[model samples]
Target: MAAKTVTIESKDYVFNTLKEAQNYYDAIVKELYNAKLTLTTGQDFEDLKWIYSTYCHYTKQNLDKLSNSDITGFKGISTVREKGGQYIPTECCAIIFSDSSSNCTEEEFFTDKALKEIAIKQNPR
Candidate 1:
């Protein structure tokens, strides 16, 4: 079957399947990381590179397993309508994160004084 073509914000692309869309998502993330590294310093670049590489490797490894059904999970349709006898999916917004985990304690969330004290104690420079 021929791939479906879609346009986003005036950009056009042909997606063979949902896997292609997933690959596009991963590519965008990698490119964003690369751009950030171009604007950052030694420690920040190294840390971001390590994080981006890990994510990219995992995404590429699982790319083949993605399908059309998975695409629905990535975006939510606000309304479905029949136009010219064809049903179209109208996306309201994309789902960016699935995990709702919080990494910081209530003290960290409420105040940065504790964090600053810890940093000063550790560095002392």
Candidate 2:
């Protein structure tokens, strides 16, 4: 089968697979780091990078091998939904953390101080 292809956001290049896209993204991240152009997302860019790296590793390898640390590392870095002010983290433990399909309340998602606390909690020790 042909490798799946995807276009990266905010860029024009196409990647054959998720791994290829990630490699390209990693290269850009490295270049940004070298140029001191990294922007802080959630906590620091470095922390988010580590979390994403861990996520990618578990996804590529056996997900059954994922440890508690791996899930906790990224579970708290929430992203705001495009349509609402609600915060949504991609994964939490074995759950794909999203409230889109449920009758979740706005309070269910972190915001303001709660979001900040999540970021702080996810930060590396």
Candidate 3:
């Protein structure tokens, strides 16, 4: 099958292979890390760092060790909702990549480190 294309924010990432996808994902994580460092602190900075950390934790294993399923599963959209029912999307940190086929909310995506860790366990090397 042809590779799937996932867009996080306005950037477009095309994955022709598992490795390709993971590389893109890793690159994005690194980019987020760098971006976080440039920010002045507060919500935006913390949010970016959080995503970078979470991505690292999720993709800590060698990229070669990941399977096709692992790559495909980690596709998501970046957005979060405020307490007043407002949806907010931040480019500095929010990465919308997930493995579960179910829909995930912004709250679960950003604040659910446990879920990410579980996903790592589910797709062991």
Candidate with top lDDT is 3
The most accurate candidate by TM-score is 2
RMSD of each: 21.4, 17.2, 16.1
Better of 1 and 3 by TM-score: 3
Where in model 2 is the C-alpha error above 4 Å?
A: 39-125
Clashes of each: 0, 0, 3
Each prediction's Cα lDDT score?
A: 0.31, 0.35, 0.38
In model 1, where do residues sit more than 4 Å from their true spots?
1-9, 37-125
Residues 67-110, candidate 2, lDDT per residue (tens digit)? 32222222222233433675553311111222334331211121
Candidate 1 per-residue lDDT over residues 1-125, each given as its tens digit: 43333222112333344344444544433454344322133432333233333333434532332221121112222345467999985322222222224221110010112223322333344
| Per-prediction TM-score | 0.22, 0.27, 0.23
Model 1 lDDT at residue 19: 46
Q: Residue by residue across 1-125, what tens digits does model 3's lDDT show?
A: 43333222222222344444445444554455455532334443443334444454566743332221122112233444565687675322333332456443221233234223533443455
Q: lDDT of model 2 at residue 13?
A: 45
